[model samples]
Target: MELSLDAKDTAFRDEVREFFSTGVPDSWRDRVRAGLRLSPDELTGYQQRLAARGWGAPTWPVEYGGTGWTPTQLCVFWSEAARADAPHQFHQGLELIGPIIFSYGSPEQKDYYLPRIIQAQDWWCQGYSEPGAGSDLASLRARADRDGDDYVLNGQKTWTSYAHVASQVFLLARTSHEARRQQGISLILAPMDTPGFRINPIATMDEKYHTNELFMDNARVPVANRVGDEGRGWEYGKVLLDRERMVAAANVIFLGQIVRGITDAARRRKIRGRALADDPGFAAKLAQFTVELTTLQAMVLRLLDDMTRGADSGPRGSMVKLRWSQLYQAGTALWVEALGPEAAQFAALDGATLPADMPAALQGALYARVTSIYGGSSEIQHNIIARRALGL
Candidate 1:
């Protein structure tokens, strides 16, 4: 069936697709389609191009360089962008911290940061998870002592995605000592150039430096760097999580795009002198996945519909995040399994080359392994679902 978008939405979608088809760099789209990581230059190039079009931060306040699109429109933009292999703007800057800054930051912070974020001038990484306190974020021991016009921060944040490359890091630090652990926290934006700030790179199984261990040894942060009121970061951080969950929820559609590539591979690969697509078992598996993908798409659209009507997303973002990660991981497993030995070979496609030892299908499978870990572990999300949604 055609997209469930109405005539107006369909028209808008066509416009976006056309824009992505022609406006986005052909070489960059080639890299995204082949699962090749874009170089830093290419990534920022795409981000700036999107910003120049006013599509860089679609969900932000229009006054802050956002599109002011409805949730459905936002959903359409993402789905179409992914299908067209458009490089997404950096999430730390575009999705996570931008909203936090807008909602809880000072007007001066907004004026300084929002345009830079949209224009891809500043790269951001999250500093929420600490060495000893990740899932139990409120119990974090990373303390920042107030010192006149500045706060002296001393702590280590682990699994800080892209911290090594980021120009800034948004930190959740304990600024107060109180009986209520949650009430002692505050959000601080630290420039990467701060004295005593460092990042130790950590490579994933995919052999990508997507994460790092962040060390802040008596880093000097100006009071002006603090967002919102002191001792309220736990609350603001939750807002960021809610937004993150919305992103993880949308992963269902992006992951679904892999199915199309898999099918094309199956068509070209022969099994016993016939196409793998002709195999009954493979066909059945494909059919099952189609059903699952359909359900996921429908569920996500419903969530977006609610947001379009101005209903709060709330814990439902967690629900979708949990389900999307699980489903996408499972689907990736099938992709690798179906490809078997053929996926073992690496060949350049769409002007992008795969890592010599890593085939496209296996690369995807390996990457999917971390879906349940980031954006809060499945266990953490389960607890959130139980406590907030189920009233446990």
Candidate 2:
């Protein structure tokens, strides 16, 4: 089918394309396309540039430093950004907590946090998952006891991404022991430098410090830092989770970029004096991925359209997350395999410069194993679709 945009969205797409071409630096794009990690300074600096242009938080309300674009425009922005290899803005702050603070926070809380988040001034991390609670987040055991104007927090949070670099954390702590596991949970904001807070990096097979374990030993936060009412954090967390899934729908565009890179590599590499791209077997696999990616893109558009019209696309985000994760893993595997044994030259976290394409592709495939595991896991998404969408 010919998937076409309306005149307005088409113009917006061209505008976004122009900005990415001119506004973003070529070095950043090259590094991102190679799957090399950008430093914190590089990330924040780029975000600041986007903020100055009033496009820092694309999906946010206009009153809150967003572009006020339609869902279609927002989709276009993310798609182009991915294709251009722009550094993704820190979503823990912009996509997750910024909305929560604005929608459920006190006036003082909004004034303090919103601008900082938009400008990338204060990096934030989520403190939701614990040793025993991840997919079933309501089972988190972090405790927060009221002590006058302060709440003393004590718990351990595992799989906390970017805690080592974050200046703040939004924690979900149990304030009371209610009969229902989901009840009595409260969202609390605390500075990472709090006297009793500690962060230790967890080593991964990729040789990267991408996640951490957090220890909160009597980390005292002002009661004013509480988001919404005490015991209503479960409700706020649900909102953030929903937004996270929906906002990530455009990630299929990145997969498209990966596939394009694979095709380019296939054309360049030769096997027995013939280009790998000419091999029927390899070409067929690439063609299948292209078709699957096109279908996923259509699903994303339909989800955006339904959201714009206030229609409930039940478990649609789950479906996208599930399919996208599977495709990402498969695409990365294909990319590395197509590169031959040269793909085994992997880059570590200590590398100062971007690795060669083959090495970077390998590193990316190693990391791709986590795609299906995080963001509520493939199993959870299947269960969601089975019960909600399929009525099975």
Q: 352-384, model 1: which lDDT tens digit per residue?
A: 765322365566667777878887889998998
Candidate 1 steric clashes = 0
| Candidate of highest TM-score | 2
Pull out the clashing pairs in model 1. Answer: none
Per-residue lDDT of 24 in model 1:
62
Q: Cα lDDT for residue 352, model 2?
A: 46
Segments in model 1 whose C-alpha atoms lie over 4 Å from true places: 23-37, 345-358
Query: Ten-residue segment with the worst summed lDDT in candidate 2?
Result: 347-356
Q: Put down candidate 2 lDDT per residue, 193-275, tens digits, no spaces.
A: 99999999999876667899999999999999999999989998767655755655656655666866687778878999999
